[model samples]
Target: MTDFLDPVLTFIADNPSLAGLICFLAAMGEALFLIGLFVPTTVVLVGAGTLVGLGKLELMPLLIWTTLGATAGDAVSYWIGWKFKDTIKNIWPLYKYRSMIESGEEFFKRHGGKSVFIGRFVPGVKSVVPGIAGMVGMNFTRFSVVNVTSAVAWSIAHIAPGVIAGSALHAISQISVRLALVLGALLFIVFLSVMLGRWLILIILPLFPNAHAAIARWFSRRPDRISQWIGHNFDPAHPRSTGMLASTIILLVSMPAFFWLIGEVAPNEPMVRADLAILNLFDSLRTPLGDKIMVFMTTLGDGVVVTAVAVAVALYLFAKKAWRRGIGFVIAIAGTAIFVPLLKLMLHRSRPMELYTGADAYSFPSGHATLNAVLFGICAVLIAHERSRWAKAAIFSVTVTYVIAIGFSRIYLGAHWMSDVLAGLLFGTAIVSAFAFVFGPIHNEKIGRLTVAGIVCAVLAGFGGWHVHRSFDAALVTYAPQVHKEILQAADWRQTTWRSLPAQRIGLNGDAEEPLVIQYAGSLSDFAGLVEKDGWVRPPKWSLSTAGGFVEGETPPDSLPILPRSQNGRQPALVLIRNDPKTAKGGRWVLRLWPSRFEIMEGGTLEPLYVGSVVHEDILRPMGEFSGPKTDRDLPDADNNPARLVPGAVVRQRPGGTPVVLARRPEQPGLASQTGN
Candidate 1:
């Protein structure tokens, strides 16, 4: 496949004549039944679009050919339905399509011929909508009008990009094939991620209840003073055993498979960035305000901060009260907020570029994937309970569609890796299922913290609303760094080595060259973090970043760059935290990166800067430290940061200049400090 593209690109580069035909075939093949299913036509569509942007393909001709093919395909599909609607009902492949036909019928019955236009987007109906319209005996004149209007819109939606993408690729060809692919891929991946992310979230959400149950069970089982305290106060009958046992089974059965898929796929190709580009383009075109409306699309669901808020609204409308609903909603969101980053940290995934972009971080178990699963899964569960089948079906459809859309948002936003989202969905669904069984609505709360959960959820929701009311993006900052690379001696053997173990070749370069290579060390953390760094950069959780070879007159290895010590835009900046003893795990630390002003002119170009990186050891005194607050001030103060980190190692590119400070052990009762030193 790699062998196939270069020559074609070269040919197009010279001829410029064949570009339209190539795109035409691409569009036709994409529309052709069964064939289009295998190819993931969208990839080719964008490739062609990029070619157009590069001037290799003419926009009008390319759009015209592709549009014609798409229109023809729809027309053919309509004719087949009109002619053989009954024959298809009993035919092999089409037999199962009866349900689809039925669905299209209902949709049209409900929305009239307009369903033809809307159903084109919906799966199950994409190919069959036109046919169903024919089967239902819509007037030929009306159908023609609808089809032409819809087809033009669909063609533009599907094909305009190949033309422009062609141009963008042309625009940046000199940037290096890897960078160009990575950037273009970033754009496209972001487009598709949020939609596809739903599937992954569905899988994982079902496991949430299992995790919560386990947490309850573990807290009870501990013979420790804290366990006893929690148990005595929080209620002894909280189903701790059930939660633990279920969690153990899930860990054994599903977690391993989830991680393995992540290892094999996420880091290898990572389609998130490329998918996002397509999504962004869709948003720009679909949104009445275009890119300006992205503000609303991304923040659309931000209103439902706590499960309680959504739960309250749902129940209030239904005239009912259900604590279990709140639990599902709250835990689902909390789990994603807490665990996704930890997973990303454990995985330490890198972003799409040699130099990290704004969205790059540890991305496994995407928040969108996790939360969307919970979000829509709850909707599905709610629908699943309705007395009417039509009601259930309606809710299920909306839920599934919603999950897909949110997942797409994440991908489109360039916030998650493909597999990250995939893993998130699977795990999320499993969790939601488990929770639904264990904590589904009960008559009472004798065995759980349902009361606390409700209050906590409500409080959180209100706080989230306040943040929205005040301004969610008030603290948000964005940086798009183009990291350049150097092999540094392809054979340099004595490069950076991990204290953890043995690997002869394959070192981590933060985010390196195209087809960016990181030795698969097989540890869950290295493997996951290797792929999803884009969404995974919290402290205790590390990710690939600071990728650049020092140019002439840049800051020396020993000095930190100039950056504001205090930042107000976003509380969680992508800050680099150095951990030598590696105690910073779990969900204790909050990390944020604050990028410095860019300087196009060398010397004038200040190094990238970050602030407010807190390692667990720095913020909290372990039990051994006599349990007290720090008397010292916070960092970028000289008194504080030097204890656990070297600022220069974090501020910019200093690969071997990687600075790691060993965690200081607390003074033991009978031993002197020099005993360890």
Candidate 2:
């Protein structure tokens, strides 16, 4: 595909002015007599749409070129028919396929100008219908009028879907995975609706006669007000107009109300708390296996994956002659792409801080959650309509489960709050429901070629999964510097080094335990002052129940709780504490800092005492267990509590370290003076 498209794409990319001509020629070929039957322009038009999205071609020019080309193609066929008249059927291919020409003539006679309009949407019939009109000596003015209108609609129907698909792909790739999921879901919903709508139209068409008779018989039996009301309101003859009016009313009223509600409550503290609680609960339950599963499920909701599905579905619908549904699918997706970003900009809500990699966008109305509800929900609706009872029920169940899982994945990954997901579900569902009302209640036949869909989806997911992994990995690597800066700023401290306490001298009682000691080059007052900076507030066990002190910017706090007075005081001691609910990691620290001493507990702050008051010999130890021996007096067990130090490279060891001592009284005045100096 690339080999075939590269030259064309390059020509257009280099000489953008010729894009119109190329599009015109391509669409003309797709619509021209005889040539239209063989040339598959759907792929070409879709490719051009993608190029337009990539900014290689201008959108308006492309649309115009395609429309004009299609109109011209039909005009040429009409002229051929006019000139040849009744003898045109004697031409080789025409004579060979005289039945098709005869049928077109009959169809034209039956539907009149509307056949010309509807024929533009069907593949083989489109080229033949125009010629049949001319052969029948249809009014030239009327033929031109129908020809131009259908051609324009036809052009948009083909080209716009491609453009929309390409544009959606581009937009999602530029943002985070979470956002991509949201957009993907909306696209999925639109595609499903279009597919379903096509099938529904078919099903409804055949049933219309039966329905009318049944209704008449039932009405005779009733002869009542209810029957009259039903007939008056739901009369199928004008249901499309009724549907449009009702859909319009619902969309106008409900969409604004939904947005308004989101706007009103998004900034509320309670909402924030709810988000935190749900996220924390999920995060606590997360395991490596679950994470892997969530990652794959989330990948399915990616923009690229979803876009591929939409394009594939659109092509299938077009192939099946489901024009209205195909066009609606494209419109629905395009609208979703436009709306999501606008909402995010308006709300500007921040993301939770517990994410593996920092997010760069606002959080309210999570894109992933919205996508899950809209896209997967639509898939369920579509599948439920045509499949057998058990299959439909099973497919519907899985789709719902998948949607829930995707939403949960976002929260578990700390990409969004629960409220954000909730709002997303609401927004996405409303959009889908509104669109369904306008162009749907899709009752499409069961679409075959599941193998094709599966292959496309698998390829998309593989690529999207790789893209997401690369993006996330890169984000995580660059996150540390920002984290360090944020942490320092929050604690109200600049970078400083300290002389390490000598491990042997600080009452280790001959114990061989060596704990990682952080070397800070500052006074006790300076450390306390940094802690008092409000952003590093003490955890609830030591203070208020409501968590606070830090806010999410671009990184999460590494603070944990530890008791200063006792081994089990419940107060977070000697650690940098971020008490904010948004940034909390739901764990305690193993290390602690004090005025003249540092402590390393056995297992986090809650564990038994491991090593305490090890005034380092001006070198911060690099490693220690959370729980172990209290004193250095015990013999080192080879397999058990081995002592290690923080790598000297990290702390930047001095060439010849300064001799620092920790003693209440000195044996000699000279030694004491030297230590002080």
Task: Give all TM-scores, in the order shown.
Answer: 0.40, 0.35
The lDDT of each candidate is 0.45, 0.52
Quote the lDDT for 500 in model 1: 21
- Global CA lDDT of candidate 2, please? 0.52
Give the Å shift of residue 219 in candidate 2.
Answer: 14
lDDT score of model 1? 0.45
Across residues 317-423, which tens digit of lDDT does each residue of candidate 2 receive? 67776677667767766677666667777777777653323232777777777755665555444444434434644554555556666776666566676677767
lDDT of 1 by residue, 1-677 (tens): 11224545555655544655665566555444323333345666666677767655566766776666666666666777788766767875555345555766777688888887887666445656777767767777888777677767876776666666666565555544533443454466454553343332322333354454456567778899998655443332553433334334554655567767665644333343333333233322222122122333334444355344455434442344455665555666566657766766776776432323333355556665676676556545543442343454455455555555556545434444455666877777666666655553343533223333353346545655565555535312221222222122211211332122111111121122111011111122332243233233322211111111112223222122112222221122233333223234211222323222211111222222222233332323343322222212122222233322221111211233322221111211342211010
RMSD vs true structure, all candidates: 20.9, 24.6
